[model samples]
Target: MNPKDWSVSQTLMHAAKIYGEKEALFDLKRRMTYQELDTESGRLAAGLKELGVARGDRIGICLPNWNETVVLFFAAAKIGATLVPFNPMYRSHEIEYILENSKPHVLFISRAFEKQVSLSQAASLVHHVIAVRFKHKGMLSYSEIIDRNEKEMVREPIDVDEDVFCILYTSGTTGMPKGVMTVHRSVVQCAFTVSEEMHCNENDVFIVPAPLFHIFGITCNVMTAIASGARMILLEKYHPKTVLQLIEKEQVTVHQGVPTMFLKELDQEDFINYDLSTLRTGMVGAAPISPEQVQKIRKEMNFELCQSFGITETGSVTITRHDDDEKTITETVGRPLPGITVNIVDENRKPLPPGEVGEIAVYSFGNMKGYYQMPEKTREVLDDEGWFYTGDLGILDEKGNVRFVGRQKELIIRGGLNIYPQEIEAVLLKHPEISEAAVIGLPDDVLGERACAVIQLKPERSCTEDDIKQYVAERIATYKVPENILFSSEFPVTASGKIQKGKLKEQVLEHINA
Candidate 1:
């Protein structure tokens, strides 16, 4: 499939022709076939063109996970406009930054969230702000465009593989979010890789409980399912009960989410009562999962729990094969997917030996083009050799399986000792009382940096800081044990459900200095 030969809309058009009456998308309100999706997206695209949107223009989509949001994505693609998906959790400040940075030609928002957020407040940066609902005053309603526009316009012929498909902005942990430019080729390649590795088929129904703004949710869950002609069930929010209900009701065969999501679902009292026998493939990624957790998921959930590894920069990279032994599945992330290359290297860019920990780099068709408008930042990580330095540390075993240790930036340097938080965290999770844990590096006057462990314990289960430190000290070297331990009812988290270690580090340093 030549990605450059067709636009994202053309890809859908092709699918619609093949799948036609097959169910393509399902939400709480309605179920849409591939043909229905194609017609609606075409109408929306024509509507966008009437509003002065042209090729290469940026269109901001701020709606939640719904059938409309998916329609807008393909609609913008049909017109050769780049779809800029924003997190629905963003408030004014965050939305303001993205709108200003992208300078979108048209902003499509929902008036449903206007009670909590006002699109009128951000009217300065946007040329045209259209409301998906009628609650927001002084903006065109979504029906005004799609309902009235003619849906007979031809799909724009774009360099399907090379032209930018979507500009996904990163969640700004350090500063303002950077827009990641991904082409059609990258999206299609990633979808193909995920479908191939997971063995997704037309019969598979993918249940997506994650938010649509995230790349993992969009690429792995949305695009991958569409590429495979599989039905996708979209959830507005992730309630454990809702997820289980959807699985049983939809007969979902493939489920994908982060470890935290799986843990939360398991914690639900009614979790075991649900009829999830239809589920055959379960995938957890975006953050590290302990081998014990994987085992529990397999035993309790009764689904094959496969651990994969990837990031926003590189779409699905490595996946645990279904045929692998339990030990290999638990220990490594499996080999790189076909057409993907994994390399571990030191600071000097020299490839490291197997079993050595270093920065994990990847070369794949799924890699993002680069950071939008940030050439220096793009070049800093992506070298001339086509390798994207992941800023993550991992080791390749003798059999060429990759085991992620930690992120290089998150590595704690305590008195010249390098401690990976994931290692300590895995050990801490083994403790009976501990349900979740985050290890961070805190500033130390004498040692330069000290390790701190923040834990969220099981309800009513109590543990002191000394107990945690003692527990880790007995399992690992003394230097690797945390210098301080803190307990929290809840830890900060990212949109993708990973623990926000950076935020926890800030909280730890504030208390230690106080």
Candidate 2:
């Protein structure tokens, strides 16, 4: 497929043509061939049109990693609608926030979640809500939509290179989440880059353990599989037992997940009982992994564990190449793929030489247009020179491989989920007893890092850890709540009088461990 001329829909259609009879997607419930997926998605697109959806409209996808969710993604792309995939684990407040921000014309949701969380009552901006069910709902069912609409519709070819294919909202760590606008060309380039580095082929069966809402999961697993004519096995959620069973049952060839996920799976006592011989490649991203874990995985799982480094702003830009040495795969985030360039720059924006630590900047076709609706925030990171400053501090080795370092921002990774320190601090300051607050990330054994809140209470005002935790938990999502709280008389300050967060973090870690 011509990367410039093909839309994401066209890419799927072309895959359907070439591998029409081959299985395209699989779940515990059913297996869909490429031909079936194409027909089903086209029908869903026609149904969406009947319901007044048109080009450039925003469509919210709140379903789990099921066949219907995959179908809706392609259907939206088929009709040139921007897909806004929300995490199914989001509470009503989180869902409402995204609904208001994205302002989707329609929402596709599952009838019930694990705890019977319903979107029908909570979503205000959704004009129409379509429900998928294990049992029939009074409203329109997924099967009904496909059956009622025609199987084939005139696919108006879009300018694949220019059209915005998806608007993926980042998990808000600092404030309200920002929508990252990704174009078709960037998505395709990302898929091709991942597929090439992983040596994906038609015979490869990729297991998707990450949520489809995440860019890494969608682009690396779904789009890469479609572009390479490979098979995709979708699991609703990651359960170590289910994941192991599926891998052995389907003989999955490629596995992709975050570092936290792999850690959880490795901790399972029965992990060694599963037959994982068919697994040839595994990829971890979104968080850093220790060399100890990497060595253990290689010895136990018997597969090449490669790490991927990128963010939503720059779709998976660098990957540990398949043929890279164990040291390269473990120590660095391998070289940039074709058409992508990495630059390490100092405070003045001048490029630093190899082997020096500086801000990691990227110039790539895969970079997003900008943060949606935040020109000021967008300008702060994206420069006029086309380099996107990734707020990460890292060094380039003599061989041009980028090594993993710490982040410049106060973004915390808790079990692969981003927890912004500013967001937590803002919520903590709302307490009546708290006069000042600072949040930091403390290293953890299970999660890569956990949130730690350090606060100076109003003079003579007494508050306990429970009080502080409950105060923040009531305001934000549970994940954003600090796992540790420290009461301090005064925070350490630098010469400029700015609170020294590094020292505060160390203090918090010491206090917690003590």
Candidate 3:
């Protein structure tokens, strides 16, 4: 069968037939083979069909990394239903907004978060509320869906080339989170591209510590592993010691996580005690990693690191190759992936020169269908010509590699000079005493906005604000030095391990007020 004609459901059936006995998924409580995965998903699909779910129906999934999460994703694809993945960390108001917007027929939620998320408030929008780990008083149980021992239903053929497979809500840093409509074709294409680029295959054991709800985890980890027929180790929660232990226990080869996760693991005093020799290839993305950390990960973690740059709107954009040199891997996110075209454009949407920093625009099969129910907003970012203005600032080198600067909204204009926060943050991270750093634009009456640096120091390391200011001044121009410096033990992060700079800016404002 031609790969372009293949749907996610078709991929699962193929994997089950070809690698029936191979281990497919491992979680805290259970391990499943490909055959088991296929059977369980079939049972759930049959149950969902019996519950009035039809083609194009939406099913909301709000759970952590588990075997069930994998099953539901496949089951939704098999039955032609669109999966709506929800971040498990969202509060009641946030959850309510998504539920009201998507209006899924069924919502599968973790029982542990019932109180925190106030499930009852959103129950009206969803016809059925299926609790995963434990049964709620008025909710259905996951076992009830899987216990229906109906004969394995034969999967139907989907367009595969064009069909909405999932709706993932964006991490709302600007306003209300938008529901991104991701199709089967784009998902398959992006997953295959990432797997091929990373050299993943059946023998590889992939571990994903990132959240299943996020696109990075779904595309690069779950979908990529399935596309390659590789084994997957899912973590319900992240702990530095536990993850290191799993790498040793499972002999994990391919691992993926954000820079913060890697930084934490390396900071673990006993990280070297674990056997990580099995690791061969892994990726760091979703947040910026300094060149210093890249060297540290390569020298200490013993893995061929691939640095990536991507967004929820586009699947896997640019990724450093396995054989890429240290300068390319550390300094730039490698050229665009297969079937993807990227360029830097000025404010007028005209393409910019190779060395000039501008908005990063992309044209690819991996771009989302559109923002669900927001045509105006979709048209604003994704133009009529099919280019997606990423609202990110970057410069493309003559060799085609992209050097990510920072978010356009995060740009600081102080005294008529432009300051990219990522540039400042990268320099701050290079400081020996600083473990993590975030730079944000603060309100300044004279300059309109002043640059502020917030840093988290390494354990037992000490540095005064003057020392940090001097270190940055010596490395860069005086105008770029942050007018304000604040220290914290940790920065606020989203579910996908990205530093929430907007929140950090708010914290700085509160400090100034205090």
Candidate 4:
């Protein structure tokens, strides 16, 4: 059977049939084989079905990298339910927005995350709250769901193209998070293509350091593993030495992460101690990596690191070939995947000539369905003809390779995570002590870019850097909080009194440099 025609659940079932008894997932010391995972997912699917989780119902999962996370993913896909994976680091402020917008029928949170994000807060927005690794007074446990039903039930057929697989919330320029409706067809297609691109097979061991909530982890690590029948090692969290140890111990052949993760592992004091010779191929993307850094990774990591470019709106569209030259890997994000059409277009949507920087537009069957409940917003980016005019600026060479230049939208990609300045600006504007706010991205060696807030205070209102940080920290994710807070009685603006972010960023950089 062709993978493109199969649903996410079907992919897992196929892997189970082909590579039964082979280790499929390893989270910490715990492990699960392909057949065990298939059975467990089926059991959980039955429980979810029994609990009124019918087709189209949204199921929210806010947990780190764990075995249950993968199980939940397959179970949701099997029963035709949409999964909404949230970053567990989010505070109540960020979580509340997503919970209300997605309005999930069920939500899964870990015991550790429950302390950070109260179960009661989510209980109001979500119908059922299932806790992992904990059984509270009234909340359901994850074990209960798996054991609630002993047998697999008949599942409704899944429409790979039409039915939504997952709803991923990504911050937008409109100052709110918009849920991108990714379908089963796009995911399955990506899995097959990426697996083939990396030359993955059943004997490969793939270790994932990125958070499962991100598309990079979901598609490249989990979905790709399922497609190729690869053994998976999921790190609960990313640590420099821990990754090196896992790669050495598990003989991880395929790995994927942002540049920061690779840097940390390389910078580990005892980096030479680990035996990473088993590493053969993987991807390094989501944030900018310098040519020098790319060279360092190739020389030190002992793996053929391929640079690729993609967004949550679309799965992995472009990837460098495994046999690419050093210059090609160093300079470009590589050519588009099979059947993927990439166009470098002008502001008017006309295709730009090679070597000219313009908005990158992509046309593929894997593009998102639309922004959930935000049709007007979706219409703005995704045209009627299936072309998604990505707000990213890029230049295409004559060879069809895409080189990313910059972002047209004022967005911050910190450590491979998308953080829209508008969303943070919206939260900053809510601070009682601020009159005007502009959040700008600053250069950073580690995080790629750190946020800095430029604020103009209201007359007679006094606030310090700590006050701003503390206040903003209370309202948004810690990652979104500005690392540098600057106060100015006034800011440069146009005749219309609109803040000039470009001008503000320049001034702030000058001030910080001085």
Report the poorest 10 consecutive residues by lDDT, candidate 2.
493-502
Question: TM-score of model 3 relative to the true fold?
Answer: 0.98
Return the top candidate by TM-score. Answer: 3
Candidate 2 yields a Cα-based lDDT of 0.80
Give the whole-model CA lDDT for all candidates, comma-separated. 0.85, 0.80, 0.89, 0.85
lDDT of 3 by residue, 417-489 (tens): 9999998998998898998899999888889999989989988999999999999999998999998898999
Q: Listing every candidate in turn, what is its Cα RMSD in Å to the true structure after a full C-alpha superposition?
A: 1.6, 10.9, 1.2, 10.9
TM-score of every prediction relative to native: 0.97, 0.80, 0.98, 0.82
Instruction: Report the lDDT of model 3 for residue 470.
Output: 99
**Of models 2 and 4, which has the larger lDDT?**
4
Clashes of 3: 0
Per-residue error (Å), model 4, residue 37: 0.6
- Candidate 3 backbone collisions, by pair: none
**Candidate 4 Cα lDDT to native:** 0.85
User: Candidate 3, after superposition: displacement of residue 147 in Å?
Assistant: 1.1
Candidate order, TM-score descending:
3, 1, 4, 2
| Candidate 1 segments whose C-alpha is farther than 4 A from its true place | 1-7, 112-117
- Model 1, residue 133: C-alpha shift (Å): 3.3
Off by over 4 Å in 2: 1-5, 113-123, 134-138, 411-514
Task: Report the number of backbone clashes for model 2.
Answer: 0
Candidate 2 structure, TM-score to reference? 0.80
240 in model 4: Cα distance from truth in Å?
1.1
